[model samples]
Target chain A: MLLFLLAAAVAVAASLAVVLGRNPMHSVLLLIVSFAALAALYIGLDAPFAAVVQIIIYAGAIMVLFLFVVMLLNAHREDEGTGGAALGGRPLAAGAALAIVLAAELAWAVLRTRRAGGSWMGAGPESDGTALQSVRTLGGVLYSEYSLAFEVTSLLIIVAMVGAVVLARRES
Target chain B: MSSVSTIGQALNGIVPVMCVTLAGIACMLAEAFRRRGERMPIGGLGLVGLAGAGASAVLLWGRRAGCLGVAEADDFGLFVQLVLVGIGVLTIVFSSDAVEREGLPAGEYYALTMFALAGMMLMAVATDLLVIFLALEVFSLALYAMTGLRRRVYASAEGAFKYFILGGFSSAFFLYGVAFAFGLSGSTHLDRLAAHVQAHAPAGGLLLLVAMGLLLAGFAFKVAAVPFHMWTPDAYESAPTVVTGFMSTAVKAAAFAAFIRVFLHALGPLRADWLPVVWVLAICTMILGSVVGVVQVNLKRMLAYSSIAHGGYLLVALASGDEVGRAAILFYLVVYAVTNVGAFAVIALLDSREAPMQTLDDYRGLWHRSPFMSGMLAVFLLSLGGFPPFAGFVAKWYVFTAAVRADQYALAIVGVLTSVVSVFFYLRIIVMMYMTDKAAEAAPAALPRVPKPAAAALWLSVAALLYLGVLPTRVVEIAARAVASVL
Candidate 1:
């Protein structure tokens, strides 16, 4: 539980760094840290498969692509450095809105004792509703009940594959 | 006999999905075999496939009412399918000219479109979280590739990269949420989750709320809601105008349809829990979408923000959690789709080699240069602004009424105010065309001839907008039936 809290804090902090950092490369790196910490939270939720996949696909592959673009485009230096933050004052306002949301949620947690009335102090079942077992269970459900949706998913992947090839290839 | 029956049942269950898949494959094969400069035939074949899917959807509609499967095919899904297929048809019409100009592989374009449409259709019917994730990625991947089709243009390629990266990030959040929901609910089937939610209603846990929040974030990105909407303007600005038209309408429709299904069915029991969250989103989306759009000089970027705001309006309808609200969303979606695509179709036609001409300054004195184009554009812009006797006005009326009906009067009032704010931007274009003389000489002089197919699409869009505006009762009735049938 403490580890989960620590990871959440780190993720939150890293997210702030990613948004507030002036350097594009630094922002990208902070995003990677945030992704890793999120993976830890996924693991804490008992979704090992998802945790592993998140780390591998998101932290490893996707973030590398972002870093690659940052490097390749050399956008880090040319990102209109000083005025980028001032392009809109909305982000700071968005942060305040998010804080309000958090406060509202916290207040609801404190006031609401209608049924399973108690403090949310890790006092009950650790089942986060969708655990790793649920993922495995979903696989079974996808095969047996939603098999068609599964096949459609595969077809979509194939189409995406072909599309990427066609789009990226040079004119013949 | 039992095996045969089982196979038959399986095929029956998979028909809607199969329709799109088979059509996409046919388009792919046709593309492979087609020769150069004979791309028209390929485009025609792809349209035939999408039309067939639409026909199949019509054929199978209401026939699978109680049939057991991984997903359900009801009137709601069929409505979404029809809308998506219609968009696909319009997309071809809109892209034909642009495709010719760019010298793209027509085969790939048609095939990717079909594939994306298929994913969208699947999303509408998907009853499982994993299926939803997969379907979302399917469309997202196709869009990423399509956005980069003009690879020689550095901005286009960069836009694709940004969309791809951000899309992957959001997909990860979706999957994580799915994991959390599965952990808490002990299942991923939306129906089963609903049942579980009801069983544990009073015993609500942070786990369910967290799962819901994550899922919301994922969809927030998909719908391009504020905060998660950072990628939209860049992407829309950089992509080909025709592609932008298709993406803005088709993708938004599919994502929002899935969103409605998940929230209304799976989380229906948790209405009290999520309603407030959605309320805030709705307000933020509307205000930001309208206000920011006014400041954008770039036409595509302005429209992108407009799309974000529209998504918020739809969210407001969804937040209402009433039968009237659901039906209003569908009605509003249809109206919005026609007006938006019509607007884009005109914009696509106006582009030239020297510059894209998407800025308001470039549009100055457009009426003097090409009356027919500017006139059509004025109608679309007015419709977008919710002017009287136009579809946008009716759509907004329905949505806001739904909000009022649900007792979210504050939201409804805010919706009205933001809508008023939105009018300024929509009118800005009109004002540029009529009132300004800033670029009268600079504006292109000759109006272009409309291709037969594109003309059909444009006319149909205008007709639909007019028909829906003047007499929306019938469509509203159908929308009500569709929503009720699903619920």
Candidate 2:
């Protein structure tokens, strides 16, 4: 319980910092910290495979790409003149109101589930006897049960590749 | 041995999609090996593939096959697949001239079209949300590229960028909804989701509603229902006219197919919950589409709004949630696809490199230049306005009847009123074509000659529409049977 609370707090704080940071580089680094906190939460939920993937794929690889883009674009700190002032009027107020309403509704749902003696969190793989977190089991399921989707994903990738070539290639 | 047999069975359900995918691959190979300045009939390859897909889809009818528990080859899917194949064949036929005239990359154009057709076919048959999402992305990516095929045109690039960004947001929303569905039911298959809904009726209340709302929003974006329709006009106007036709017709047909299957078949027990929401959407879409369409001077934007209105009519049919409504959707899709594609083909034929004729003013005195083309456009526009003796009238009639049958009297009334209001814009275009004359000094060079293939395709579309409008009973019966298989 203590670990869950600690990881959740870290995640919340880091996510807020990522959004609120002035500098693009600081934002990217804060996002990595937020991703690490999410991995820790995944570990607390007994999903070691998910936690490791969260760390490797999101925190390590995607964040590096984000950093590269930031540097390449030469992005700087948010301009004080346009940063908050641009969204300072009615749109901002409406956006905040909508966000608050959405958050409250989500909180109510979680509380309702808890009050009804239902776990808001998902069941661990041990309860299902499937070892779902293991890469081998995931592969087995992907091949056997969801094989059509797996194959279709290959088609999707081919289309993306073709599209990239079509859009990015220099015309002769 | 059992696994091998299972694989063979799974393959049987997807032969049509495979044919198109293979054709796409072949087109790519041919492009790579082509001489620098050689002209290839790559579009012919697409037609051959579509023919094979049509044949396979016909064979799969009544078989009731399942592919790896994710896609099903029911008569409903086969019917939509036949429509998609027809759309693909016509698009390829019409694109041949447009490709050369506009200097488009012919190989990439036909290949991307085939891939998009394949994705559309998969979406029609997919029974699993995950497969549906993948299929959606496959086609959307291909279309975004196709929209920007005119690399030198700033408008094309801008449209593609807007569509891609908005499309990504919708896909994320859809995936989030799928996640919520999985979390609630522990499965992504429609049958399993239906079973879960049945087992936990009142228990899955708020979360279930959220899932449905999110899914509906995703579909509404794809179908261009009002309030989520900001992307349609710009995207439609900026794309090559033929592409605009394909997007308006085939994409809507595939998306509607999945929407019907997921909502009417899977979450059917909660019809009462979603009916009111769809009801409101239908009304708003009808009103906004018709009203905004009146002020547009650009023909493409006008037709874009018209297509959104047509989507509204389809949503009215969907909200009915009855057998008649389901069958009406199939019949309406067939008629609308033929008529809309014909109209866009005319616009494409009139367009040239030096004078890309698109605005309402450009269409003025078109009858004096080419009587046949103007007459064809008149017919298509009249049909779109739901005139009798044309396919669109019958389609709208059936849709409104479905609403009336479901006791949605207000929806039917609004539908009828909007059809009347929307006819004004269609007639305005017709007036520009025949009634008004181009000023002596303002007349441009002589119009380009209509190519034989495109003219033939237009004739086919017109004939089909007249036949369906006059004698809709046979097709209506077929549509009924198709809906019966799934619903």
Candidate 3:
């Protein structure tokens, strides 16, 4: 329960920082922190597959979503002005948020080890034999029953690439 | 490990989707080589792909094979595949004009349509939650890109951005729901989930209900149903006309096919809980779509709402738990697909960059300028209004009959009343076209020239609407037969 509370607090604080940050760059960075906290929460809840997906897809893939847009926006960063001096309290808010997240992350680590009588590398308290098997079964099914779907995902990505090129092509 | 004899049959199941995917790659490669001045028949390449897919679907009909336990090559998927192919063919035909007039990149447009169609087909056949979500993203990404294909139009860019974000949000909900379902049942396959749900109901009911709601929200957004339908009009209005037609029909058809597969099959045991929620959704969608559609002056935006109401009618069929309701969905999909595509084709033919005749006023006195197209438009509009001797009338009748059979009298009553109210909006276009005077808001160029292929497609749709209306028995039989293997 204490582990849950700590991870939850970190997640909520980091998520708040993500929305409250004035700079898009800062917001993107904070979003990653929030996602990582959520993944830890999932691991605490004994859903390791979901935790891995949370890190890989939600954090990794979605970060690409924001990062690409931020890069696009970076080209016009000099043209667009930042929040003025009237909005100067951002760092105080950001620092408070990060401090809360750091404190909770440390608390979670302490609480998690206490429960499992194990270190961070140990299997989570509630997890048994099947937790590790979930990823293997997922892979087995993905290759055997859903290999066509896997192949199609590649095609779908190619189509997305073609579409992006077509839509963004400015010259004749 | 399976025998080679069974392998041959399972391979047949993948053939249709393979045809479409290969053709899409061809179009992409062709686009890279073609010179600027060269006029390539890129749309023709897409048509060939759609035709090949259609033929393969016919060959695979009633096969009832499962491809590696991930997809079912049943009558249900094949029937929907044919409908998608038809929609793809018509959209390509209609796109010929839009491609030339709008200076749309032909190779990109045709390739994207084929890819989207392939995704829709994949969605229809997929029997697993993860595959469905991936298939959902496949088409969603392509359509999002197509939505912004109008690069110069700022609103198009805005619509695409809004669609992308909302679509991504909905997919997340869908994925989370799938995760919950897997968490609950320890399996991602619908058959396994269904067996688990059936065996252990009255326990963890609330969690199941929440999962169902999440899944429904994702599909409702795809089908453009009420409350979840905020993005429909903007996206439809700003997209290229042919694309709007393709998505408004094919996306909904594909999504509905998957929706039926999940709700009516996997969650069949939980109907007592999910039905009332979907019932309320159906009634609100029908009411709101028709009433707001009446107020829209823009043709594309108006049709967007009309399509929303049509989705509600299909939802009503879904809410009514009976074989008739199941059959009604297939029939409605076909008739609705034909009429809506035809209607949008007329709008596409009459539009150009300078004089984009998008408004209701723009259609005024259209009969005087192009009698052929005006008459065609009249037929499509009348069909949309549920006029008899038109396919929409037959489609709406079957939907209401299913609702009545399930004792959903209130939904049936509301459906009939809203369809009548919807006629007011449909006639609003008719009044502008044949009834209103010529000079009210005449543009400098009276009618945008209709290309030969698009004109042929419109006439073919008119014929289809008439055929389905006059002798719906054959098509109705096919629709009925399509639902039998799955349910």
Against the true structure, whose DockQ is highest?
Answer: 2
Candidate 2 per-residue lDDT over residues B1-487, each given as its tens digit: 9989877987888889999999998898889889999978888888888889999999989998888888999999999999999999989888888888888888888899999999999999999999999999999999988888888788999998899999999999999999999888899999999999878764569999899899999999999998899999988988888899999999999999999998998888888788888988999999999999999999999999999999999999999878889999999999999989889989998898777678988888888888999999998999999998998899899999999999999999999999999999999989988998874666687777889989998988899989999999999999999989887
Q: Indicate the docking level reached by candidate 2.
A: medium
What is the per-residue lDDT of model 1 for residues B44-105, given as tens digits with 9 covering 90 to 100? 76677787878878887776532245567778877887888888888887888878776666
Docking band of candidate 3: acceptable
- Per-residue CA lDDT of model 3 for B191-270, tens digit only, reads 99999899977464778878888998888889888889999998999898889988999998999999999999999888
How far out, in Å, is residue B395 in model 3?
Answer: 1.2
Instruction: Compute each candidate's TM-score over C-alphas.
Output: 0.78, 0.84, 0.84
Question: Lowest-scoring 10 consecutive residues by lDDT in candidate 3 chain B?
Answer: B439-448
Give me the runs in candidate 1 sitting further than 4 Å from their true place: A1-143, B65-68, B437-447
Roughly what TM-score does model 2 have, to 2 decimal places? Answer: 0.84
Candidate 2 achieves a global lDDT of 0.90
Q: For candidate 2, write residues A1-172 as lDDT tens digits.
A: 6888888899999989988889989999999999999998887777777888999899997998898788768887767777766867887888799999999999998999889888887543344423344767777898988888888888888888888788877878
Please state the Cα-based DockQ of model 2 relative to the true two-chain complex: 0.58
Alpha-carbon error at B441 in model 3, in Å?
6.5
Indicate which candidate wins on lDDT: 2
Candidate structures ordered by TM-score, highest first: 3, 2, 1
Clashes of 1: 14
